[model samples]
Structures are given as structure tokens and as C-alpha cells.
Target chain A: MTGELAIKNLHVQIEGKEIIRGLDLYVKQGEIHAIMGPNGSGKSTLALTLMGHPKYQVTQGTISYKGQDLLALSPDERARAGLFLAFQYPFEVSGVPLSRFLLQAVKARAPETKAQSNGRPVRRPLGQFRKLLHEKMEILKVDKSFAGRYLNEGFSGGEKKRVEVLQMLVLQPEIAILDETDSGLDIDSVKIVAQGVNSLRGPEFGALVITHYQRILNYLKPDFVHVMVKGRLVKSGGSELAEELEERGYDWILQEVGAASTESAEEKGADPDERS
Target chain B: MSDHEEHLGERKSQGVAIAEKPQREGFERDYNKYDFRDPEQYAFKAEKGISRELVEKISAMKGEPRWMLEKRLEGLEIFLSKPTPTWGGDLSELNYDEMCYYIKPTGEESRSWDEVPDKIKETFDKLGIPEAERKFLAGAGAQYESEAVYHNLKEEWAKQGVIFMDSDSGLQQYPEVFQKYWGTVIPAADNKFAALNTAFWSGGSFVYIPEGVEVNIPLQAYFRINAENMGQFERTLIIADKGSKVHYLEGCTAPTYSSRSLHSGVIELIVNEGAQMRYTTIQNWSTNMYNLVTQRALVYQDASMEWVDANLGSHLTMKYPSVYLLGKGARGEILSVAYAGAGQHQDTGGKAIHAAPYTTSRITSKSISKDGGRASYRGLVKVVQGATGVKSNVMCDALLLDERSRSDTYPYIEVDEDSATIGHEATVGKVGEDQIFYLMSRGLSESEALSMIVLGFMEPFTRELPMEYAIEFNRLIQLEMSGSVG
Candidate 1:
């Protein structure tokens, strides 16, 4: 696939329990792709597996980002390669200031700031970095005073999601994967967070947003929405599928797929009898 | 042995009161006399060494006030009575008296930098003490051996009723206040090493911040041990009065020697109501040194105390900076970074006692060990029965560079009240191969990648340090990484 993110036949497992089975996905540049599913449907599983999270064992699949094998890279390497994952449950890294953490993340992506420790590099002083971080934070509705706080520590649920969005905007990752960004946000908070995500859409950046509800989809309006059930994407459609799923619910699709499987099984049994 | 005991008295107590007392006698005495005429000779050293009589003589020679003397005597008794602790790093190789107890420089104290002896001044110059003071520090004091020889303060600070001087000089000048508050936070009997320090306290800084005054710039003390077998005991005491604020920075270095030098000192801080105090230390003791120091502070209502410690050197070091939340709304924090290389063991941590309601504390400790070095974090977070609504968080991270290195954490949490919130997290691991490969693929050498990973591991602590110290600390990490990767 000629796109920012392309995963073909992606099969992933944890402790031999296959969580994402033959998952195929592609997100083009400047497009917002949403993966909607119920709990235990491997939505988060696929998100983590795509980002090179160590626990997810990827098998029989090729995850390519802009024609490079993304599966072969470490999490940080993938992050450096412009693949960012806003974890549904962000890891609390104490003693690391959010500003400093973002600075390192930015410097990792930008080559000019990387200097040997022994050499004196005349880089931007901390004040400028602080100001830039504050500007980004203000854009994301984050308090400026949070620059000094430990990353994700003592953050309210909405605050945590906002911090994730703030990092996504500041780091400017090309393929940002947000897993359940609207899980804990209030209605207004969800809208604000969606607005922040919406602001990052561009030809240079593509996003894969994972959600379990259609409420956020109303605000985001992903160009393509895929339905995932039982570790695989059962159907693919446009943004209308999200509205359809919200209206018809997951049971209708599950029944249709389940009945089709039973009918195929009965036909196969009858063919065997006629052959005998 | 009897004759040796008799000869100990003739030694004049080495006048320095080294780390270990009686058994470290003649070796310390001869070394303190500037015996290295060639300036290029080296001496043999030991790893673990301390003793009791060394404590007694250290107390006796200082001519300490009667109460302090008695406290030291009590400390000596405790040192003899208590068993060596077994919970932290291994202490089996330590030999009491094998270490020089007292090894002060042989010279008269000089108030002016120009008046300091040429040799000592050269050492200080090499360490960049004078230049650092001139460039950034508001005040500077240089201590060699067991006493501060040259001290200076900005005229503005002096005029603002601030007092900064050597601890001994402070006692002599302000005897009443000194006596009233000395050992109030950390009594001699608090620990064996503290007792040892109390017995032979020497060249530490004494700072008094007047009420409602705030010192804009940081005052610094640079301690350098230029002599072989020298024992430097510097005592420091800081008092921040009501609504006052102060920042004190201290750094230490010792010349490369084969024989071991011992450093034991005490630091006591008193933060009055609404006051804030920050103490920062960056120590680079050579591998032939044993550094054991004690530091504690009492935080009054709405006061705060901070300890920013970086331990980059020393063969074996045991130091824990602690804070006591003695008043409501008081706060305390400790940010420490330690690096232990081959033949070094860094056992350092912090303690926080929430004795008042609504008090808070936080401790962030980071350590890295390489090539047979051992780094350990041992800490305590305690909340008394009446200290309701207290909160504390402690995070310890130790990075082992190779298979030969070791890291351990022993944290004690005691919450005597139901309303307290406490959290602790620790991690011990080696540098992941993938992290190294990723950095190497980006064109960094293996050593560079390793250094970057190590720096990243210590980023939590370094990011909190001041700019100059952060730069210096990164350089020290690079130096420690030398010969580590290749």
C-alpha cells in the first residue's frame, strides 16, 4: 500500500494467545482512519502491536510505515520514525518532567539538536524550550504550570488524555495512533480533545484513532471506519458505517456474520453427503 | 600494641581527626606532614575501614564545647556497641583504623584567597573553584584538609544580615545560637557515622539567612583534598529564618592516591516557618576515598527543604540526606544521582519523616553501576500517628551496565495514620540491546550510545540540576563510561 501506515495480514499474539489475527489496515496521508469495536475485540491489541510494544508478538504479518518494515524497530525507534501511540492508559513515569520528556522526544526526532555530551552545543536554552512547550500546551488546553510536573502523574482522566494529545502535537509524529482517547473524557472534554486531534490533520501526518464508541466519531468524522470483531476486521466502510453501527448496534452485524458461517457449514456437510 | 597506644598520644592527634581514629595513627600523621616531596608518588589504600578510638581522639582534639564532646563520647560508645548494618551494600572488607582518621593540612587558616598557601591555591585553581565563584556564585569558600582557609561573601549579602562562614568560626562568633540548635535535628546518637562526624567535625559551612530575606544567587563551597592520606571532615549548618530562602551548593574532589583517605562530616539545617532551603552537592572523590556523611533538616510550618545530591566518585560511600516535617504544610524533597564504577560501592538514599498534618515529601533516586561496581538505594518514608493527610512518593531506578554490576533497593515505609498516601516504585535492569542498536544505527558509536542510554537513565535527576552542574554531571558520566564499553 502506498500510504503512511500499511499493515497486511498482521497477526499478533501474547503468550501464545492470538489477539490480532490477520488484521489488514491502511491509512493514507491526511486521512483520519477510525477502528471501532467492542471490548476484547483486539482494537487496543492491534494498536499496541503496531507501535512495536514489546509484549505483543507479531506473527505472519508485515507492518510497513512509508515502505519501511515497522515490525523490526523498537518502540523508541518506531517513535523516532514518527509513529506515536497515545496509550489508552498512559504510563506514569515519575520524576520525569513533562517538559523535559517532550524536549527529549522532540530532540530525538530532530537531528540538529543531537550533540555529543563532551562537545559544547549551542542549542536553544531551557527557557525557549519551556516557552515552546507552554505554547503547545496552551493550544491543547493544558495548564502551563504542568510543564514542571511529572509526566502523567496526578493527572485527571481528561488531563491525561489532553497530555497525550499535547505530546502528539508537540512531537508532530507522522502516524499517530490514539487508543481510546475519549474513554474517560466528559462530553465537553471529549469535544475539546477531538478538536485538538482534528487540528493535527495534514498531508504530512496520518492518524489511526481507536475507539469503542461512536460519540467521538461524530466529532472526528474519520474518512474510513473499520469494524473489528473477534480479533479481525469483519467489515470495512466509510464514515457512514460508524453511524450505522451506532444505529444498528454490533449485534446485527454479529448475527449476520454468524448465520453466514452456519449456512456455509451446512452446505459443506450436504456436499460431503452427496459425494459419499 | 601497648607501646603503639602510648605513641598515639605523641602523634598530636594528627590535628585533622580523620575518618577512623586510633588504628589509623602513624600513617595519617606522617601523610598529614606533607611527606610526598616528589608530588608524583602514590600510596596504598583500603576499601572498608573505621574504628572507635579514632572517634575519641577526633572529639578530643577539636576542643569541642562540653555538650558536643559528651555527644561525641556517646557516639563513640554507640559505634562500639552497635553491630555493623547488614541490609545495604556489603561491608565485610571494611577495617577500622586501616583508614586515616584525621589528616588535616599543616598550615594556618587564611581569610584572603591570596594569603592561602601557593600549593593549596594551585590545587584549588586546578579544580576551578576560584573561577566558578567569580563567574556565577554569590559567595565562595575553599576548604582544604580539615578547615576552610579562604572564605568570602558578597558585600550585599553581608549587609543584609546574612552570615556565611566556617562552622567552627560560626560557633566561635555566635556561640549561643550555635549551641541551642546544634544536633537538634540529627543527634550524634542517630547513627554510627553521624556520631563519628560529631566527634571530629571540622571544615563545614555555616549559613544563616535572616528573616524575610531571600538570597538571589547560590553560595558555594568547594572542598578539595590535595594531600595523600588526608581526612577531611567539614561540618555544615544552615538556618533559614521565617519567610527566608537560600540555596547552598557544595562540591568535593580528591587527588588520585593509592592509600585511602576518609571523609566524614555532618550537615544540619533548620528551616523556620515559611522559609525554603535547597542544598546541592556534586562530589567527585577519587577511587581511593571513603566518604560517609550525614545531613538532616527540620522543616517548620509551610517551610520547604531540598537536597540535590550527585555522587560520582569515591571507592565506598554511605550518605543519606534526610528531612523532618516538624510543622504543618511543610514539604521536603530529595533528588539524588549516583554512579559507581569498578571497585566502587555507592549506598545512598534519603529519609522523610512526616510528623505534622498535611506534610508532604518526595524522593527521586537514580543510580548506575558498571564493571563490578554496586549501587544501592536504601530509604525510609515514615508518617507518625498524628500526621494526618500526609503524602509521599519515592521512585528508585538503578541501571546495571553489564553482567558484573549489581543494583539493589531496600525501602522502608511506615504509615501510622489512615489518611496518608504513599507510593513507591523501583526498577533494576541493564541497557537493552535494542536501545543500543537503535542509537548505533543512527551513527553513534557503541560507547556514545551507551553513554546516551546512561544519561537518559539519569535524565530524571540531571534535568533537575542547575545548568552548570547538569553539564558537569554529563561529563562525569562520560568519564565513567570510559573503558566501560571498550
Candidate 2:
């Protein structure tokens, strides 16, 4: 209940259809949690809802970040409050250079760069900011030409995923939810992106990574691995739980839960609505 | 439930913050601080409404020759005979009787900056015309209300035999050269607005680049309308002779007013054989102004013409710049951008005509509409018979910022030659919530995110502008986008 990112009994609906049902989660300070699920299992849904995407409607329950009611803030306010979400399929925003976008974003997120007297917003010294940007980009191995090209306007899938991680390293949010950040990346790119995210790990940072494949877990070390199925978390344990699912698949857990429900129903000898 | 509605105030403040002119990168200055006002005084003024007597009086005031006087009367007859255009934005709100035909702020154009009127000089100074002209322009003219208040040309260009002056003086000093190509590209009877401009034209730039002499630096002009219910009908004529090249930039801005103003002008460009000319216009009229302008170019053999136009402010604007490729191997291109904010309508486009063999043309238009605004692109591409090997392509892209806005594209193509290749592409899209969320996740407020997206959408046109004009363009757009998202 007092974690960096905590969600309790959350229900989400998109365009009148429920996508996430009774989902509860907790990510503590400096802890990395991985949510692994099959396709359409609402892993991406949970991340988007946390980021306050207007299309994903939160129907019930609560999401609190660092003991604050996160839903009360707009998406930008949430960002300024130190929360970030790396999109699964990044949107291409043409005409905006990556360098300019990053500069403005850094200014907006940092407290010192807020609007000052006479309503004029202040910015950091250009030379200092540019030097820092070049250094971070070099760490991510992004080409200098990428600075001038429109943000993800014509990026390949692997390039898009890497750029998302680069943004995380630049913004350095307190709680980062990376939705399939390693989805389409090649082996080398996957290692590079994971390294960028790994460098940000500290007492000031917490992250919830959502993915369908366990291959990324080899590079990104998760303290806890959770299995999500049909909009609910079916199981949770240490890192070995991911190895079990990767080998045996999800049918064993579904079988156990299905049989358990049927046996309990027979013993009760009552209507289904009352059995709960 | 979340306190969803309680954040409107925050959104509004955030929107307003984006509008406050940010210091340009490394410039450490804001131009919005320089906006000032002056009393609407005049040395001479023409009466309201268009009449034959008023046209004759205007010609007499300038001491025009008999042929020019006769031409003015003929233009008056055409304007009286034609009716107001019924299509393309609302024109019923324009009142001819309530409009003042002309208001001359100064008696004569100042040869030196100090000789200019104090009030008029301050206005242009605030607009940053003098500073920008000093750095890069070959010549510059500033028009206030109805007259050219100040004009100056660099001595180098004067020595190179380039004629840069107000249209009135171009008529008086170089009568033969001015009278030959004037109105030939945009004839008086071409359209109602053209006829109206010819009838009551007053102050605009006239440039004559001699044969084989290229004017490397840009020749620029600035136009401002200061009074309410006033009319500005300026006529611009540019002639680039054989093997000569020139680029002319014109910028317009006006103060906000309670009532409506009308701006109807005619621009004629004659590109002689082997010559090239580009005309760039940045029109930031106040929201109360109704702008209807006719601009056209005639290109001779192996000549080329380009129009780079940006229309960012107006209540209702109807303008479509056109080029006529009259000679073989002539080329034409038009890149236009329009932004329509609250209570504004921008109806603009480009037209290309292939009248000779082996002619090629291209038209690219980008438009954005927000806060109940409407932006439309209406274009035409025609290849006349026997004009073989003609190639034309038209691309139009529109972005609507919010649900209240609207955008549309209407393109007409006529190909008479069998060998011609013509293609057209248009897209109309609203700002996707996904894109907005992406930028917002980066900590940009909703309005700032939207404005950045809009600027990115207009990068093609803005990149073509010079540094000073581009900065001014971005500043105007930021102001227009303020408080637009709530």
C-alpha cells in the first residue's frame, strides 16, 4: 500500500469493454518488477492506464504513486511528478527534432527551469545542456544525425525501442513503466537498451517492465516475476517463477485454478453469486 | 472519483504560459514586449467606399499620366460591375460603405530613417524591420496604412542599376519601365479583387532587376494596418529580366481592433526568359481583417517562379496564388501554409498552369485549424492542349488540433496532353491522443505539446523562411495557440 507505484483492485475499460479486471500491484523503491503475460492479457493496458491515456478508462479502484493519488493528476502533471511510461508502439511526431524535444522536456521536468518572473520560462545554459545531451546520446550510441531528424518519424522498430530507453535515461523519472521496451529489438540492441535502463537503477528509481517473452529477463534482472492471464495476476514469486512459465507454459496454472473452483463449488451446494 | 474537472484552471494557466513569447535560442530577447500603439492620424485621407470620382482623385493626387488615369477609370468600371465573391469563406460580413478607401500617414517617403515620422518609425522599429534590413536586405520598404512612410536601398544595388522604390515613385521616375510590365501578369479585369486593387492601389514595392544582373540579397517590405474599418489596396509589381534572379519577401502585421478591416491587394510577377524569381509573403493580419488578395506570375521560356506564402492571422482569408507557365521549359512551384485559430477561416491554395511544351510544376500546401477554426485547400492544375511532357504534382496535408476544428482539401486537375504525368495527394487528420500523450509524458503541457506538433507540421514552410521571419512566425503562432486547448 506504501510502495513507489501501488495499484489496488484496479479495473480498466477501453471503448466500453473491460480490459483490466481486479489488478493489484506494488513496486517498491529501487525494485524492478516484471509483468509477463500472453498476448491480450492487459499488461500494456495497466501501463497505459498508469500514464493516464484518455482512451483507457479507469472504471474502479485506485492507483497511488509514492503515497499520492496518481489519477488526480493529468498526464503531464504525472510526468512532472516523476512518473514515466515508455510506449509499446511509439507515435511518430514529425517536424519536431529529437534534440529540441529532449531539451524542452528536460527543462519542463526540472524544478529550476519553471516559469519565473514576468511569466517568462527559464532554460539552462545552452552549451551546458548540449554537452550533457551529447554525452547521454553517446552512451546510448545514437547517431548525431538522429538529433536533427524528426522524433521517431521514420525510425525502425528496434530504433524506436532504443529511443524510448534513451528518453528514460534523459528524464530519469522516479517510477518508469516500460511497456515491452524489448519487443522488437535485436540481440545487440536489447543489451544496449537494458544497459541504459540498468544505469538508472538506484534508491531514487523504481520500474515496472511488461513483456510477453522472457528472453529480455536474461539481460534485465527483475526482483519479482508475475504471471498475468485474462486481466488478472494468476501467480507471483521470485525470478524462478518466470523460468517455470517459460518451460511449462500457462496451462498448468489454469488447470489448478479451474479444478479448485469446481471442487469448492460442489462442496458449497449454493448459487454461484453467493459462493463468493 | 478523481477530481477531473478541478484541473481546468491549471490547464488554462499552462496554455497561457506557452503563449508568452519564449526567449529565442541564445537571443535573450522577446519581441512581444515591443508591441506599442500610436494615434491614428493622417496627412491626407480618401473618403469611404469605391467610386469613379475617388479613383480619379487618387490619380490626380499622384499626378499620374493620361494613360494611367484612363487605366484607373477602366479599373473602377470593372470593380463596379463585378459582385463580391460568393464562395470561399463568408464575405457577407464585409461592408463596402463602412470601409475607408485610403489613409496616408506621411506626405512623402523618407530617404533616411531620422526623417521618418516619430510614431511611424517607432512602429517599424518595434516590428524589427530596420535591424533585419540593415543586416541582410538589399533594399527595404515599410508601408503604414495607405502610404510608404520610409524607403531605403543599399548603394551597391543602386549602382548595379536595380530599381527598388515605392510603386508611386516607380511610376513617376521610371515611367517607361514601370508602365510596360505593370498589370500585364495580373490584368485589371482578371478578378473582382484585382480590379478593386487597381482602382484604389496606393503603397507597395516595385522592383526591376536588369538583364543578367542578379540581386543576391533579398528585397523586403513590411505592411501594417493601424485603423479600424480601413481598407488597404496595395499593388506590387516585380520584373526579373533575362538571366536575372531575385527573391522578395513581404511581411504584414496589424493591431487588434473591435470592428472589421479589409485588405485586398494584387501582386504581379513577370519572369523574363532565363530568369528566376521567388516571392515570399508572411501575412499576420489582426483577427478583425478580411484578406482577399490576387497574386499571379507569368514565366517566359526557361524561366521559373516560386511563391512561398504563409497566412497565419485573419478573420476570413481567400487567396490562391497562381503561376502561368507560358513558355517552353518553364517551371513553377508554390509552397503555402495557413493556420486558422479561434473564429478564423483560412481558405487558401495554389494554382499552376502549363501553357507550353515541357513545362513542370509542383504545389505543396500545409494547413492547421484549431478552436472552431476552419482551414481549406482549394487548388487547380491545368495542362493546356499541345503542352506535351508536362509534369505536375500537388500535395496537401491538414492537421486539426481539437474536436472543434475542421480541415478540407479540394483539388482539380485537367490534363489535355497525353504525355503529361499528374499526381495529387491529400490527408486530413486530427492530432492523435497517442501523439499528445507521447509529448505530455515528456512533461510538455497539453497546449505546448499541441503547439510543438503544429510547428513540426509546418516545418517545411518555416525552414524556407529567413531567420528573422522564421522567429517572428513562430512567435505569432505561439500567441495564436495560447489558451486554445481548454
Candidate 3:
């Protein structure tokens, strides 16, 4: 129960349209969970909702982190409570250097006791912070120039994903939600990102990786693999489940779970009569 | 000028004494560091009005030369004849007769901090001026109200024939040199505000660097306005002789008052052949002040001039620092940043004029508006005829924090030369919701996220400032960004 993120019967909506319907998940401190789903399965929605995005309206759910009500906290509060999210489509914030942003985030995440008497967060010494940053960048194989460049501005898709992981390593959150971070990465880049994540693997770090393909799981080696369809998990298993899905597509699992794969049917032109 | 007498009567009936009551509002809360006012104490305070008699008295009080007195009278005539410009922020509410034209805080200037009056010295101590001077400044000058209370140059620089003192002292000590270069770059007929400044100018830095002398450290001047309904007109003139190099910095602040105040200043610089000059200003007036200023420089052959200006506070500000390249291969650069919060309108930019062949210049402006504030960039780039091989670029970027805020760009480019190269770019953007959410997800508060974005937008300007100033400017931006989120 300690250092655990528990979501029970979670339902989320966007603009009065239901997205996630009755999704339940529990991630402990020392576990790595992978959610594999096709397009439009509410994978990214779950990630955003977990981070308390303004756009995602939670209709019914109870999210508890470390025995506290996470729903009552703000997005920044949730982050300071040891949660992180690597966005599926990271927004480019021009003008802010990556190192400067990381330093602010690290300061904001410090405990209240570390704050000064004026109730302002005390900044970490520049030399110490730079040392930590350089070490993390080296682990992610990021060039030195990346630290001084504007955050995510003009960065390639692969660079963006690596920086996301790079941020996670620096922040060292207890639970990180990676939302399709490997969607647009090459095989080599995927391995580098996985290595960056693996460097943080321990009894104190947990990750919920959302992906459509099994390519990244080959390197991440998650402890649990759950097949998500339509909004909720349908089948939960081990690494072999991922290999099975890679060998044969999600059609067999969709039929076994009795849920129609709307995306696949639409692609194959088999759902002409169905209205979206 | 005749109509001001009627308004002066109305201002008295409204009880002008209450203007010094120090009304604390939400806007003034964040500016507490600069909002603390000292008790009004002055050796001589001019009556609240401006006229021929008042201008003559100001010139006579300084015991200036006959030519300077005649110049002041002529400036007064021009100022009274010119109608208020309607193109910039509203100046209809500015009352000339309701403001004290001059207030002499101390009888004489002191070369050491200990000799300064205790009250004025305490004010500068609170502002951290003396400590800053001891740390890195080559020389420092402090002006309180309409007089320079303290001014001193390090003996090393002073021994090298480098002159750094108040403009009044410059005229009295080096009359020949001051007379030779005074009003040469920016004349009284340049604009209405310049004319007003020329008529009532009192305390500003006059710096002169001898030929072949390089003052590696910067000379700084601090200006403070204390009384209510006070108009401060400081005139600064800097001359860098051939093969000389120097950097000058100025900062201004005022205490919060109920009634409006006016600050109109003129700064002129002459960079001789192969000389280098950099002038920086950080103007942070109170929210109840109207800041209208004119600053220009004349660069000679193979000379360079750079202007780094940042405007953070004022109810309305209209300023455009310009550089005129008058000789071949002259270089000019201007970097400006403006931040406008609630009840503020900042109309600021830069101008570059190429008057000779093979001159190059660049102008970069960045502005941020939040909470119904409005910021506009009004700039000009002119290349005259026969000024061939001239290259110039202008860039303006504005960031609006909310839907209620506004930003505009008015870029005027006039190119008469056929062989000139000119480039202009402007962008207006809002702080994206996605960007805020992304930063917030990484453990930063909303205000912190917004301030980071703004500081980033101003990196080009901050990078040109000294390390201490960059830190102070960042702190000021952070203060402005705090409690900005609703």
C-alpha cells in the first residue's frame, strides 16, 4: 500500500463524451506495468487523467497515491507527490533551456523542509545540479548541446522522446507514466530510451508504459503486460503475451474478449453499417 | 500652457495633500521593495507649475551660462507651442501645471557615501547602491529627486582623465567640453518631450572617456523619485573619443503614489572614430507614472554602439532608442525587453538609420503582456539614398499570457538605396495550454511555468546584461509573475 498508485473503477470523459469506462489498475513501487493497446483505446487519455489534466474530466474514480487522495491535488502537486508523465505528444516550449527547466522542476519537487524560511523553495547549488544533469545526459546518450537548447523546440521526434526519458531520470519520480514514448523512434533509439529507463529500475521506481507495438517491450522487459481494448484491460499476462501479440495481431484477443475492434474493422472496411 | 492653469486650480480643490498618503493596492504589494517612500524633506521645492519664469529660475538656480539659459527659454517656447501627440498612449491626463518642475533634495553633492544626508543615504542603502558600487562599478552616482546626492569615481579611472559626474557638475567643471558637445545629437526641437526635458533637465550622468583609454568596468547611475506629483527630467550625455571604449548603465525607480507623475529624459552619445560604447537602462517606474524618453547615438567611421534597454514598470511608456550610423562601416545594435502587467501599456522599440555606405545594424525587441495589459512594438529602419551596401535586420516577438491581454507590432521600414539588404520579422503568440500543462506535469507551479517562458523569451536581452543585472532582472520578472495565475 505504501508507495503505490491505486486507481479503482476509473471513468474519464472529454467534452461530455465518455473515453475510459471503468478502468482499474494498481501500480506498486517496485513493479513495471505495460499497457498495450491499438489506436483510440484511451491509452493516452489514461496517462493525462492520471496527471490531472484540465481537459480530462473524471466522471467516477478514486486515485490514491501513498494513502492520500490524488484527485484533490493539482497537477503540480501530483508531480511533487512523486508522479511523472512523459507526454505522448510533448508540447514545444520555446525559449526555456532544458537545463533551466529541469533545475526549476527539481527545486519545486523538493520537500517543504528544504524550502527557505520565506516559504520559497531553495535553489540547488548550480555546480551540484549541473553535475547531476551531465551524468543523466550521458546515460541517455544526449549531446552536451541538448542541455542549453530550448526545451523541445525544433527537436526531432527521437530527440523529444529521449529528452522525456532524460527528464524522468533527473527527476527520479517514484512512478512514471510513459505515454507512447516509443511511437516514432527507430530501433536503435528505442534501445537507448529503454536503457535510460532501465538505469532507474529498482525496488523504489515504478513505470506504466503505454505503447501500441511490442518493439519497446523487447528491451524494457516489463514485469506485467496487460492487453487494453475499448477502454479497459481485457487480458493480463506475462512477456509471452507480448510475443504472441507480435506474432499474431489483436484480432484473436479481441474475439476472445468479445469486444469489437472498431479501429481494425474500420481499416478493413468491415464496419460499413456501424456508426461511430 | 495657459490651459494648465485652470487644471491646477481643480487639482488644489481635490486636496493634493492626499496624494502622499501612500495608498496600498494589490499591484503595489508585489513591488514593496521599490514602493517604500521616505518622508518628504527638501531644501527647496518649486511651486507646482511650469512657465517662462519657472524655466528661468531653474537655469538661474544652477548658475548656468547665458547660452544654456537661452537654450532653456527656447526649449520652453517649443514645448508650449507643440500639441500633444495622439498616436502613442494617452497623454491627455498629464497635467503640466500640477507637478513640481524641480525639487532640490540636498544643497550640495557629496563625493563619499558618508557625507550624504542620512535620509537619502538610507534610501540608497535600502536600494543596495553603495554595496553594488564597492563590488564592481568603476564609478557610481546616486540622484535623489532633482539633485545628485553622491558621486564618486575610482581614483585609478579618474587619474586616466576619465570624467564621470552629474550633468550639472559636468557643465560647471568642464564648461568648454560640455558646451562643445551639448545638444549636438538630440536638439530641443527633436520632439515635444525632448523639448520639455531640455527645459527642465537637472540631474543626470555626464561621462567622458579620453582617447586610447579603456574603462573595462561599467559606470552606473541610480535615479529615485520620492515626492508625489513630481516631474524628473535628467539629461545624460556621453562622449567616447577616438580609440576609446566604455560602458554606462542607469537604473530608475519611484515610490508608489496616488497621483500620476512624469519622467521625461534625454540621453545623447557620440562615439568617435573607432570608439566603442554600450549604454544600458533598466527603467522600473511606479504604476502611476508616465515615462516618455528620447535616447539617440551618433556613431562614426569604424565605431560601434550597443543599447540594452529593459522596461518593467509604468502606467504608460513611450520610448524608442535610436542609432544613426553617420560614417562608413559603423555598427549599431539594440536589444529591448518590455513587461506590461495590469493597468499598464508599454509602447517601446528601437530605431536604426543608415546614413553612410557599408553600415550594418540590428534591432531585437521582445514584450510580454498579462492581465489586460497591452504592449506594442513601434520601430523604424531607414536606409537613405546612396547609402549602399547597408545591411539591417529587425525582429519583434510578443507573448500574451491570457485572452484579455493584447500585443501589436508597428514596423516602419523605408529603404531608398537600391543596393541595401533589409529583413523584418514579427510574431505574436500566447502561452499555450499544452505547454503549461507539460511544464506543470514536471512539478512546476503555474506561475513558475509562465515566468520561465517569459524569461526565455527575454534571453537575448538578458544575455547582454551584466551578471548581477541579469539576476536582478530575473528576480523582478519572477516577482511580476507571482500571483499572476487565477
- For each candidate, the alpha-carbon lDDT, in order, equals 0.70, 0.76, 0.79
lDDT of 3 by residue, A1-276 (tens): 449999999998877767788999999988899998666777778899999999888999899999999999989999999999997777888768899899889888986536666534455678998999999999889998999999999999889999999999999999999988998898888999999999999999999998877989999898999988867888998888999999998989989989876576433232111111
* Per-residue error (Å), model 2, residue B257: 6.7
Q: Candidate 2 on B226-268: residue-level lDDT in tens?
A: 2211238878888999989999988643222212278888888
lDDT (tens digit, per residue) of candidate 2 on A144-172: 78878899989998888888888888888
Can you give the lDDT of residue B261 in candidate 1? 60
Off by over 4 Å in 1: A1-3, A115-118, A122-139, A259-276, B1-92, B95-154, B157-202, B206-218, B223-231, B235-248, B252-259, B266-288, B294-313, B320-486
What's the lDDT for candidate 2? 0.76
- Chain A of model 1, TM-score against the native? 0.89
Best by DockQ: 3
Q: Could you tell me how far off, in angstroms, the CA of residue A191 lies in candidate 3 after the best superposition?
A: 2.2
User: Residue-wise lDDT of candidate 1 within A1-276, one digit each (tens)?
Assistant: 335788899888776767677888888778889998655667877877776656678878899887889888766667777778887767555555677667766666677776746544547577777777787787777888888887677998789889988888877777888889988788987888888888787777788988877888899889989988767888888899999998987878778667233223433332211121
| Two-chain DockQ for each candidate model | 0.06, 0.66, 0.78
lDDT per residue as tens, model 3, B45-144 = 7899888898888889889999999889888888989877656566777888898888776533313434333433343333344454421121112343
Candidate closer to the true structure by lDDT (higher is better), 1 or 2: 2
Best by lDDT: 3
The numbered model that scores best in TM-score is: 3
Please report how far candidate 3 places residue B336 from its true position, in Å. Answer: 1.2
Q: Please give the lDDT score at residue A243 for candidate 2.
A: 84
